[model samples]
Target: MFLPAVVLGALVLACLVSLGTGAADLGLADLFSGSDDSSRILLVSRVPRTLAAVLAGSGVAVAGSVMQMSMHNRFVSPTTAGTSQFALVGLLAVALLAPATSVMGKMLVASACAVAGSGLLLRLLHLLPARRTPADVTVPLIGLMLGGVVEAGTTFVAWRYDLLQSLGSWTAGDLSRVLAGRYELLWVVAALALALYLAADHLTVAGLGEDAATGLGLSYRLVVDLAVAAAVMTAVSVVVVGTLPFLGLVVPNAASRICGDNLRRALPVVAAGGALLTVVCDVVGRLVHYPYEISVTVIMGVVGAGAFIVIILRGVDRA
Candidate 1:
């Protein structure tokens, strides 16, 4: 109860700060005062940024939880598993091949690529016998290597087409550009979260070995596919906002540590934690430089990487 209260409080504080700390000076009072400039800025920029952060953060964290459960590995995430890179590649391809494509079309292509990349990663993992190499060690290494390869391809293409700067912006994970029309895609994340919550029981059951899940009347393959799709879609959808490094890894792992692995009970908590953390990071980014903002991606990279190192050390200690 106390923990939830604290998280909620932090989220509220972060939202408030995010709302008030932009180029335009606005506050809760101004929102109701009906001043056009304040209201316009509030509605147009601040609100969208706050909402995008929460939705993207929660969705990615939930996706990470699903990935860990379905893959039965803690280290696998969009960032680790090359899913984001695949999405990037898709987005780049769309830009090069059909520069006039709508944002939705680009997102669809990117999501399809993400799903395919996840399937390939899973296939590779399956090919490596667990008896020969421990999954905990091999899974993330394979994912990182795959991600590196995909990232290299994206970089090469972007450079060849003189779109390196554009690709850099897309991958930077900054909420500063989140305005009304630009941030609408993040709402899909809300729908995905709802789907994940409804399917929580099946996902939990599927986390048990495939044979065990089949014995329990679960369609293991179908559940796995659904989980992978949800995870990849949630991840790729947030690409418009920027890549959040280690967010899925740290948030879900923390939730499991506190609330256990029961997806039904843990999903909401993980979502809330992820949202709160992202807002806090965004707020910090806003204030850390005063008038000039640091990208949320940079802050999360440092903080999330630290949290990840701690998680890894703890795992080593337990082993």
Candidate 2:
């Protein structure tokens, strides 16, 4: 609780910083009151991008935490594996199939499809011989293979239709173009995060292992479904805002190290940690090249992957 509060406080601070420091260089005063252009850019552009980072960060981090718990492994997440790619495939499919659809409608379709794809993979895992190894590692491996297959299809289609540039733009993490009306759709993901928060206890119990959760009279499959739902929400949010790399896998593990793996207790902490990391990364992205900003995806892919490697090595050494 203390950890989460502190982290969330830091998250708020990071958000304020992100809102204030940007290409336009607005002070705290300007954030509150300024010219119409300043207000529009601050309220419409900066606010939405900040919100997107926070919401997307929270969503991915919580999903990764639940996924790690559910599978009893730390190596799994949409970003680590290929689940995010599959979700991207879903988003591209929607774009190709329904060009007239609203962004919210596209997000819904992509999210549902991603969840279904993940569900299919889960079912297939259940039907397998049930290896004793942690599901996190194995599930991500499977997801990677599945994502490769899906990406191939997406690549072929995009090339065939000359939509590769547009598809590429969507896959890269860039919040520079975020606007008021367009960004509101991500609040649906916020709602989904709230649901996961409410069900945290059940999820933690289920993460103990299927047999234990079953012994406790919780429906194991239902809890698994909920976790998948959370993952889909995370993936869809990423798809909506382009890909964010390390927030999911890194934040939750950090939270658990501080908060003792109690899902109800850790969820908020993980969310805060995620948001903090994302905002910091965004700030760094803006500062790294001045007017030419780098994407958070690249920053995380480089730094976050290094951090992940260190953590994994530490775990291996402890074992």
Give residue 188's error in model 2 in angstroms.
1.2
Candidate 1, 257-317: lDDT as tens digits:
8877789988888889989989889988988987789999999999999999898877722
Instruction: Return the lDDT, model 2, position 168.
Output: 82
Misplaced by over 4 Å in model 2 are 127-136, 316-319
lDDT of 1 at 64: 87
Candidate 2: residue 50 lDDT (0-100) = 94
lDDT of 2 at 13: 89
**What are the per-residue Cα lDDT tens digits for candidate 2 across 1-319?**
5766778788888988898878786887887786897788877789889998887777777778887777666766776556677777777777788878877777777777777766766775676565445423566677667777878888888889888987787778787767777677677677878898899999988877788899999999888778766656766676567878766777777677777768888888887787788888888899899868888888877878888877676662110
Candidate-wise lDDT, in order: 0.83, 0.76
* lDDT of model number 1: 0.83
- Tell me how far the alpha carbon of residue 51 in candidate 1 is from the true structure, in angstroms, after superposition: 0.4
Cα deviation at 255, candidate 2, in Å, is: 1.7
